[model samples]
Target: MRGRFARAARLAALLVLAGTVQAAPVHASEVAHPFTVLGTPDRRDVVTWGASADRTGDAVADRSYRLVVHTSVGGGDLRIRLSNAFGDRPVTFDSVYAGLRRDGAELVHGSNRPLTFSGARSVVVPAGGVALSDPLPGRLPAATDLVISIHTPDAAGPATGHWMAMQTSYATQGDHTAQESAGAWTETTGSWTYLDAVSVRPPTGTAAVVALGDSITDGWQSTSDLDRRWPDYLARRLSTAHTRVKGVANEGISGNKVLADGAGQSALNRLRRDVLSQPGVRTVFLFEGVNDIKAHTGVTAQDLIAGYREIAQRVHAAGKCVVASTVAPFKGWSEWDPAGEAVRQEVNTYLRGSGDFDAVTDFDHILRSPYDPERMLPFFDGGDHIHPNDKGMQAMADAVDLSRLDCAGRR
Candidate 1:
């Protein structure tokens, strides 16, 4: 009995020592900050824009514009993203400013705040380049609107915009000092384009949205500098709802395909790099496969359906919600053969009917003309019979049921 008691006591002491070692204080670096993405329900009226000009050979007026954001949240710093993602030459900016709007017309005369990139007042972004601004000192409260003004000293090149997800943006000419003179200019010189994204350090539990698609998803033809794409519309809707979601990430690559390689690469090939790899990506809205049907002459609808299923499975495995969007109408393409239409119908039918996705967004129904079932709505078509106009994109975003997503699950 004595021997057994002694052995038990020894084991108890050993266990207690192990517990003490395990309870030792851990360094902060050893502990990771639990990432949480919060939805911004009140700042739904806020949006962002980008400008990229194509200077073919003329000394056109300097391209300049202002961004107005109606925010309900206060005390947070504002950040901007500028890009030359498709420019042919290096683009330089003379100055950038952020200020309050005077009577909702233009930037307040004395309220202009200079912006910088890496502590420098100017940035020279090369062709296919991007830059993120340092955090600015702007305290925007709920219901108040803020404006961002950018000025360039030289002519801007021919620029294409990523529309559909930006809420609102404005373009104007002249420098910041002359911003108050709204009606003084003979004609608008420079251009301002709205984009699908902005950087925000939202409160805890906010997640960002990823709009994954092809050229149509990338906002191919809605006009340079106008945020008139369907995803931009969806971003506006989500913001208006005051959900704490972060912002939308435009993952669309022009000429991208679903199964085969083309402009960038196959959608499946880039999924990890584009969708799964982005920060705060809680939800992925996919609208691809039209190019696949158009590119391959012998491929069947079943092949496209299988490709979609594979993509969905990969997204689900990542523990994110996959919202499948049907391909928009594309009846007038020179390569849009009759056989391709049959495949399109079959693929869309499966997308609408199959339970393969967490939810389905019907882009086909929104862009298709009611009068002509095979063609797109006349006003919505961008003369290409594929991509939607600003208004058409807005309608597509409006069709989504925002409540189907969990705003708290984004991080």
Candidate 2:
């Protein structure tokens, strides 16, 4: 009898040391997965997936959408952010459901769950505003395809969504969001509508990195439906590596510039919404300015540098680190010229030596050809020469040092 009691006590002690012993009952929405570091568990919400929102199309009433997005970190109580930032009128979401994608628009059996806003099923998001769903109770695994089904009952006027998503989503008429079947979701779209970000509660110290850039960061040339973007590769690395920053948000807009609004809001204008507003972001990876330099917009190297400085200042004020990347070589593109090349060279030099950023990644060195020095390596170049192929995208992600991402103690 004494030996049995001793063994029981030892088992209890082992559980406590492993941080697996339950102490108190927590609300479903407030629960987190069992994850511990250094014998303690600290849980906080971190962005697992994100896309930048811009004006896309006119809204339709009583329309249902099944949006498929990829996750980066595994955790519980998933929340999603819906955007109306470019809308001229209010939008009402009557029903919203989240589930794991089985195949195409179909969801895993018994995995579809409804999401609410402030205890209500419907949420009315005002123009130029964003609505975050009250977290649904559950654990979401890393690198899984999370399908968000949305039903907009009275949506109208200009709509806000991410264009050039590269991933295929589904749409249909009526409130089919409650159904897990793919029958009603026949229409397919290459863009994600309304939704901008998805978050999950992981270990408290686990942070996320936001990649802010243009077409390359948006995975333009990479094969669609594969999630082969550079940032996606980075997220894969963070998930398996010995690092606390496990989430990655790709805020790249094709043809986007740093100083002006064209394809989407400029990096400076959308910085807060696209980077800082994201939950648990620790670093802003700046990889823009190619569009500005190539457009002949009279934006000098000094002007671009000033813009970078302002971004760094704002990000620092928000208590986050900045990681800037040297613009990659794009010599064979239609807009490439000697003058633009000079500006790019000067900017690259500044990014390498500025000391303003917490760390710098030399994308130029990684993608540029040694023989031609000014052109992208033939093996890595996509057809346009401005963007990279799948191999090059992976290379870019591999160059990022995982250790530099943890900016917890540094000021």
Candidate 3:
């Protein structure tokens, strides 16, 4: 095995390659069409933090929620999306505020700002729908802890939210969104409710990437609230890189797939809404398919390849690059078998050879064990051999060619 220091050096070299991609010219219409609220094609509302909502249930009425989401890019104006996509009845959030977090449940004094829907102070989101807040004017710094406080007074029926948030957000009873103090927030929840995405209006040229993957991208075994997921690390890298792609939204669900609907909608089905609909998105980082292969659903490499080709083609049609990744090795997991391993090898070969994608990152190369070609390196394995640990997560982030993420190449 190579020394850890040597490995780090080589990994850094790989990232240098990833970050060396040339500036791909973006059309004014590629990103401008989605921002009807601003009434111009110049808004840069890049998604900073996002969670894939799953399994709707009833929501408590007359409750206040202060959800904490981290931002990837900085800008003067901010907008948030509240979803009731899984509900069967109307859900109303009366008092909603956006503020900066100052430890625990406290908000930075005077940083709490109210968010409105359209011109109204409150709005009712119809069942299976989403509501976006009007742009609020302010300077939102990159990598800051943003708190979105919402009070749904008459909320009932199906509730849409991501269950494995990994981050700790506070909850309280009744309306407390206007308060910036911690006194009213006596409850805590691991999952984020109603709130799905937070975006900011950066410079007109700034761009963002949406990472669509499985639990590994969702930070399952990684430390909670630390923003240690691979995509989080990549965002940190992009913060200082010279590339225009400065924003990143992690859309990973715990058990998502590529060809079929399982955890969240299949990557193909949700691509438009979850990845492309957001403003200022320059690329779609597709890192799914492990769940599909490991699930033993009789999916073939050709089936997975067809899925990849479709994703790349659709992204190209949207005039955005699609950077796919080879699935990491998981032969030590309980689902590992010669048949599954064969499928993984075949798929990885395609990922490395198929010229259909704008770019490809061999996650399998950096994550697999030298001793056992098919298993995850012990250093990166998060016990289950499926998810990577914090160190492994960082390594994966380092493997990307940051430059390829912004290419203007067509499929």
Candidate 4:
């Protein structure tokens, strides 16, 4: 009986130990969180940082910007991308927070959480450098917008930005603990800090939309933080339609040409990096070649068409649906050459007739003046005769037939 009691006691101790082991929580530290780079090559390569320092004592007010990331699939951590790409001096942050914004003002309920990068909550971005956050704690939902708020104490250097893409907005904190409002962004001062890129998971069963073009597709004249660019408008439209398609990857490099190398690299040179190598890419909207006409003084229409054909073949071979877009009217552009205009017309004719594309987007029809067939629609032109304003961008996005896309189809 004594031996049996001892054995039973040992068994009870073993059961208790097992319960303790089972109850041990799995630390977030123990799990490996991975992230993939999104957008086109330019989106991955270019980093824009905002700076504001007036003459005099440099008493700059606190500045902040919101960052929004769309996860591909659910159940993964996130990291924020911050830039000091153009800063002359190190930029320091007082604090930062991550949460969801409601009604464009407040952080929604159950959405506030602290974030860290390299184990430090706050960091200094060196001149011409970037910093990324450590893995965030929460499980980001696929296609959900995760907002990152950053607050800085002093004025950064005068900043340069890609004005076309919309930016996330952020609120400020009063102290180091950064215990300020987590709900809404009412108290925040607007910032122009350049946000180069963001990292996220690939969406499950969904692919990316690659916007391949020039300055127009790059969002040259659009308002900051407004999301009024064609790609931004398209993303909102896609999300609202409940289409599982991921966000548009803006591979549009400013001043990029189809046949020649400029503004990072030519379409042919960067095709693999920009389109083929893009995360979750399945569709490409090619809106380039106008630069080639304008820049290449002696290039003929046939040359441009050949370039388009080559680009289409390469994109298709990479297992992507290529949608060719006609170049918009450039009659009034500062560099308007009658010879270039002639070439443009010839190229447009080929683009319309060329069966090389899996699909085509008629940007000329959307932006061209009804009264003046050669000129861009006056209202859409942002006085540059080249880059379109926010309104023009909206018109372009609206012209796309989303129904034509088999969003579920694999490339």
Candidate 5:
């Protein structure tokens, strides 16, 4: 009987040990968080809107700007990038906010949200540097007006901005970035200040296209506040199309050149910041060279071709495709001459025949008249004979093959 009792006690002790093992908690270090396992790897940020930054020469202290921008793709977690790229000293932004526009200088109710930087309310950007804001929560709709208000407490030196925004924005004094009404935003401006680019995270596999060109791509002749630029129209088309490349960024600068810097930076010099730095860009739409050709700076067809090839090589090295556009005819412009026209023709010929570019869009054919191949079609000309009107802009956007913009796996 004694032996039986001892065996039963031993069995009970073994049962208790088994229960303890089954109920053991996992060590915090041994198990991975669910978010770490399933969140970051598939998510990517794409540029929804961007403008090339240059010296504005309008620096001031204790000023606020209510800049309006248009988005190309809708997604959650919106972020904005401010530039001190042309400044001579560091600039501190004490307050910044993003909201949907209810009207001029007014924000949509309950939509305005504050943007933080590394969990701080302020960020200091050094000269020739850029600061990207921490992502704001919630989804931003595509093709909507996003109002960004910023205040610099000690803004001085050369201000960095896009001088020709073509969109009407507002400004005022003191810290009014937290205001959602237009009551305090009394002053008006035509350019976007400080803010250079905006981005958002879309679904995996989504991508973007950057249009690198001159005033035409910059919406020079298009109606202001109408979003009538060729790139804007292209963004609208991409939104409903089956292609995954929906994001569009216009990197065009007025009077910009492909070979030299005057308006902003040359295509070669600014390519890294304006084009390559944009996230999830699958293609670089090359539609420049008219300024270089017409300037009569002794740029030959060979020289222009070399520039194009260099741009193509650099873009390819970055694992992106290049879609070259033939320089459109501009005969009526004051700079038009037989010498420049001849160079333009030769360059177009090379752009058409050369396999250096991944694809080609014949903008010359689209905008030039069949009656006289050297001049723009009167219907599309924007009075200047160089820049195109809204109709012409839409036509240019329509000419792009949607499939070519989707350079997935074609790198």
Candidate 6:
């Protein structure tokens, strides 16, 4: 009896250590967190736009930023979330505004509006904290270029942001949050800083699905100025569908892993903040693991499967469904080998057969070439053979059955 107990204890310890990836502001919830509900019992606020936060460089002081992001669903009372997740000190934003973008560094004349934080014009977000803007009462259209301008007069710690936004945004030296002209904004950048999410109050029963992935979903190989990520394409599909999952949140990070924290905290580490913390989330669309499998770190099929099971379990525990996808083929990438290919096949087979997730999307089959079997189709290849081009991204989105994302099954 003593021996058996000791063995079980060791096994438990190993499981805990293997699953852990260090992230600040960790959640200890064994069940779904009862965060502040957005609306009354009849309606709710769903996440219309989201981007994962990673530890980039340091923040610049007295800088005015005009970040542009694309929204998935249309609703009223728009809200935005500013994150200082990796900062070591408090960062204060003295001025912030939201408006409809009109060309380079320009905003619609009457559409630029001020955003308050708890009824104040300014907000100070502490390290590892998020500040949600007070909802602006207005109609926001889906697939619109929503530009948010911010003035950070005092910020000098580690910056928290998404580095590969695949969208062009503007920055300058002064506080021009309410400007409609392109003059004040003089610099251009491809990353999205400080800002992370945008939410909106939708009609009754309108819910959302959050896509949790890596660079493929982050639009690495796709055209830079165009919103052509697989998740972006998926969002477009959800817009015209008659399903409850109208909103889509792209929570993907560039060069992110599932089992370790490299580019950002692993998927398991950031799941709570990036996926479950959002309002009215009904499903989590998970598509990751190539980095883990090809790291040449001896990550086996079982290891990847273990990660998938844990992700699905947590989502289910939160009363949400999981829509997992098989990892796409990367046979031509430099890291590919016989061992990695074997592991990929094993993982994909399990993803298709395992009954652990609520649903499965066969991304491997969709992206793989019929002739090569182990390679991506030439037309879809992004030169690296690991990522898919814009056309391939759209194909993956079109393959998804929009009805499967309906939240009715979860309810």
Q: What is the lDDT of every predicted structure here?
A: 0.58, 0.84, 0.80, 0.58, 0.83, 0.82
What TM-score does candidate 3 get on C-alpha atoms? 0.89
Q: Supply candidate 4's per-residue lDDT for 411.
A: 58
Superior by lDDT: candidate 2 or candidate 3: 2
lDDT of 3 at 285: 92
Candidate 2 stretches greater than 4 Å from native = 1-43
Once fitted onto the true fold, the runs of candidate 6 whose alpha carbons sit more than 4 angstroms away are 1-43
Query: Cα lDDT for residue 172, model 5?
Result: 96
For candidate 3, what is the lDDT?
0.80
Cα lDDT tens digits for candidate 5, 1-411: 222222222221101000101111222321321000101211378999999888888699999999999999877677788888788888999999888888899887766667776566787877766776776656777888989999999999899999898899999999999998999999999888999888888888889999998999999999999999999999999999999998999999999999888998788777776777777788999999999999989999999899899889888877889899999999999999999999999999999999998889999999999999999999999999999999999999999999988767776
List clashing residue pairs in candidate 2: none
Best by TM-score: 6
Q: Cα deviation in Å at residue 224, candidate 4?
A: 3.2
Model 4 scores a TM of: 0.63
Model 1 spans with C-alpha error above 4 angstroms: 1-75, 84-94, 100-105, 123-129, 140-147, 151-196, 214-229, 240-243, 246-280, 291-320, 332-335, 353-356, 365-395, 407-411
What is the C-alpha lDDT profile of model 3 across 15-129, one tens digit per residue? 0011111112233322321211111222457777787766545788998999998989887567788877677788898999888888988987777777766655687877755
RMSD of each: 15.8, 10.1, 10.2, 13.2, 15.5, 12.4
Off by over 4 Å in 3: 1-43, 409-411
Candidate 4 lDDT, 279-391, residue by residue in tens:
45667788998888888458789888888888887766666678888999888777788888889888888888878887778999899999987798989997888888999
Global fold similarity of model 2 (TM-score): 0.89
Error of 4 at 158 (Å): 16
Q: How many backbone clashes does candidate 5 have?
A: 0
